[model samples]
Structure formats: C-alpha cells, structure tokens
Target: MATAKQPVTAPTVISVDDFLAGNPDERRRADAGRLRAIMGELTGEPAVMWGPSIVGFGSYHYTYESGRSGDAPLVGFSPRKQNLVLYLTGGGLEERDDALLARLGPHRAGQGCIYLRRLDDVDESVLRQLIERTVQVHRGVDGGSGR
Candidate 1:
C-alpha cells in the first residue's frame, strides 16, 4: 500500500576512468583528469562519480532543520563543456577567507560552488587551499570521518 522511499544517498557508481571516457572532447577530458588528480590528492579519497557528471571525493551526511537528510560529497568537480564546477561543501564561501579567493584567478562562486572556465584560468595553489579548507571543515562537522 505504501510506496518505497527513494534512497537519499547518491551512490558512487561510475569509475573515474569510465566517467572520463564519457567525455568525448579531448580538452574536457584533460580538464577532468586534472580535477580528478587535484581532488583525489586533497581529500585523500578515491574519486567516485556522483550521478552522471560530478566526480566526487569524500562524502558526509547532513540533515536539515526540517528533518530531511542526505549524504553528499565533501568536495567534487564536474568538467562541463562551458566550465568546470567545483563543489565546496561544509561552510559556504562567505565563511572562507577573501584573500585566498582573490588570488584564485578568474572564477565565480555560488552558494558552495566555484566555477572556472579552465584549469589555467585559476591559481592551482589557491584552489588547493579552498578544497583543503572545505574538506577539513566538513570532516570536523561530521566528526572527522567520511562515509
């Protein structure tokens, strides 16, 4: 009589290589590779595909004040044709230092995401700091361990 509830967690299914292969454009593929390497090294976790596009690293569980809850990647990136979307969770951009972001080259931030047209468009060191700080904050919020 009751319908089954859909799973809240987006399981990591597609492998990094397989997902990268799905990108037909050579440049996009190369960008995905760079993102994979950067995120993998920052989170110290294996790269996992979230849904069809996002390549996520570590994951954490979150519950809203309204009671809905779900697990999401601590940090991730998607090699979209138009731009690279970086997912920086835990604390939003306002919580992060402004100087680091200023040095991050030409990019835009929305809520908890950073968008870049290309890897060369941003400073890698600043990007690394952003990812590291995001992961650390989320890990602390989730008790220092990812699911």
Candidate 2:
C-alpha cells in the first residue's frame, strides 16, 4: 500500500500540442505525432503534461527513501531535441534486459529514462513490450502499476 506522489509542478504547460508548437524542427514535430500515436495505442490513456516539458500518459505515485514523493507517468514518451525519451520504472536499462535493449536499437539509459535518436531507430514492437513489462514490474512492486 504505497501512497501516490503529488506533482511538484502544476500541469500548466504539459500539452503535446504546445510542446510540438514550440519546437521549430519539423522532424521533431513529426516525431511527436508518432510518439503520441504509439503512446495512445499502448496506454489507451491520453497524454498529459507532467511538468512544463514532459508529455505524460497514465500516472503512478512513488515515495523515495528520502521521503520525497512525486507522481510520474505510468508510461510515456517525449521527443527531445537530441533524442526521444521513454520513461519506465526499471532502474534505467538494467543489465539483465540487455537482450531487450539490443532489440531497441541504438540507445542509452539514465536513471529511468531511455534515450533514443528517434522513433525509427527503434522497433515499436520492442518498445511496446518493454513499456508493458516495465509497467507490470512497477505495479507489482509499487502496488499501483496502473495496468
């Protein structure tokens, strides 16, 4: 029974439309659309702005050891200027998932975010499975996987 974390920032600037509108790169704009479509198909929940920059989908709350609690997307993707960011519950591309990562194409991980050059670089099928498995793991541990 874990309590959900509250958002640190308000959901003011958290729209995919606004994010794409502000991005001048046409490629990034297109990437955003693709991410939106994929995320929609995966979560069946519409995306929402997590902070001023992140476009999040469903949500789950977590409290860290420091007693800091915050709400994060159940699963979501973002098209950054340099890469496409995929957030998951795993501890950032765990070594055990190397086989899975190999299928994802060229990418790196940090904390809990998976960074990619673009959607096309990675197979969406692998991405979808990764996301689903990650959600299941998080829900199993956090007691609120949002599946």
Candidate 3:
C-alpha cells in the first residue's frame, strides 16, 4: 500500500504579523506590509503563514503528470535577506504580458517567481496587475490552460 505524501510546504497556524515582523531589515518589513495590503485586497484573503517564511494569501491544489500533488498559495511573497521573492502560480511567467514585464522596472523573473530588490523599484500598478493575473489563473477564472 502506498502512503499519501504530504507537501513539504504547507500552511501553518503562525500569526501573519509575527512572521512578517521577523523581516531582517526595515525596508523588507515595510515592503512586506505593502505587499500584505496589495495581495490581501486583490486576493480577498487574509495573509497566512505558509511554511516557515512565506506570507501567503490564497491557495490552490495542483497535480503533475507524475501524479504528484500538493497545495500551494495562489499568490505569495517572501522577503528574503537580499530580495523580495514573489511566488506566483505554477502556470509560469511566459503567460504574462510582455509589455507588462518590460514595464515592471528592474526585476528578474524565474520559472514561477519574480524577484525584486525593492518594492519601490517597480510600478505598483503593474505589480498589482501581475498579482491579479496570478489570482485569476489560480482560481481558473482566466481562460488559459493554467499550465
């Protein structure tokens, strides 16, 4: 018999305030607060402590071709020592609008995350749009395959 595997990162009962307060620098803490507000308003979900470090908003379940499955945040961010890393949907960044990325200010996009050194570096409206897209993708509201 096979056992049901659990995801390595899952939501915890940790207080969102407490987790956010742990930011190592003042800038990160402030940026985290701004993100909490933006993501909260966009997702209509309160921030939750996902795993030990991520301040996540909503969640979605996913399965791969290998049959491995787990739940993940619809949108989230982690204020690391060096960068504010955003965990967008697994559908990846290719689906994002090219013009938007071009106007997103100085930042780097990963397979499913966007990294920025400072929130002040980007256009807030564009960031919000990217986040809104992630929420839409995870909720299956967007007509894409949500790959």
lDDT of 1 by residue, 1-147 (tens): 999687543756668798788888888888889889888888899888788778888788777667777878889888888888988854447455478888999988877788888888788998998888788877885343322
Model 2 lDDT per residue over 1-147, tens place:
999665563355555688767888788778888887777777777878877777777776667767666667877766788987888764535564567878888888866788988777788888887777666655565343232
In candidate 3, what are the lDDT values of residues 1-109, reduced to their tens digit? 9997776679999998988887679999999999999999999998998988898998887777787777888899999999999998565485555688789999988
The CA lDDT of each predicted structure is: 0.79, 0.72, 0.86
For every model shown, what is its TM-score relative to the native structure? 0.85, 0.80, 0.92
TM-score of 2: 0.80
User: How much is 121 displaced in model 1, in angstroms?
Assistant: 1.4
Poorly placed runs, candidate 1 (over 4 Å):
1-9, 141-147
lDDT of 3 at 147: 42
Ranking by lDDT: 3, 1, 2
Candidates 1 and 3 compared: the better one by lDDT is 3
For candidate 3, the per-residue lDDT at 64 reads 77
